[model samples]
Target: MKKIVYAGLFTFFVSVISFTARAESTVGYFGFEPDIITNYIGPSSKKMGYVRVTIDLMLTDTSDIAVVEHHTPLLRDALVEILSKEPEEKIKSLTGREEIRAKCAE
Candidate 1:
């Protein structure tokens, strides 16, 4: 009985550790969500006007959607760089929305 209990306990611990070792990042793990600015808020928003952008980002192994709250700037920067010169037409339009989603998925 004692040997059986020890064997079962050992198996449980090993399985638990193995499960943790196999985690994978989901599409939402890009660390941040895209932000669309429709209006400025003085010095806080600077001279930037309302614009839409799609951000495609690489995800860190441990990142998730929740981390987006902390990485908003990163997402905006990436989107701006990739989708520059057409923020208004690209982000606000229906086609742009689809493009944004496609880019983000990749």
Candidate 2:
């Protein structure tokens, strides 16, 4: 029957599309938008400025995104680790700048 044949073809097409759907974090774009800014004043006016963290935050899947339920914590952890490795001056000036790109690229 033509109807049966069409139904089978439709199912096969859907399967192929689902199988070909790619999931990659880099392609998903999970990071900060516009920018992430924070201010810090320390040492009795000896130092005062803002830190900007730029990033993209997106999910490749169609499911609802819940950072707590997903591996998204890895993103924050990586940034923290990188910040820990930065020189004191670097962290003071651009606290999360160097890490913004690195985290999203992961």
Best by lDDT: 1
lDDT of 2: 0.55
Clash numbers, per candidate: 0, 9
What is the C-alpha lDDT profile of model 1 across 39-96, one tens digit per residue?
Answer: 4223343555555433345555345555765767766655555554445556566988
Give all TM-scores, in the order shown.
0.32, 0.33
- Give the alpha-carbon lDDT of every model: 0.57, 0.55
Query: In model 1, which runs have C-alpha deviations exceeding 4 angstroms?
Result: 1-48, 52-76
Candidate 1 lDDT: 0.57
| Root-mean-square deviation of Cα positions for candidate 2 versus the true structure, in angstroms | 9.0
How good is model 1 by TM-score? Answer: 0.32
The alpha-carbon lDDT assigned to residue 58 of candidate 1 equals 58
For 1-106, candidate 2 gives per-residue lDDT tens digits of: 9999999999999988877763322243454334545554544567565555565555555353565237655655565455444444555545455564454456
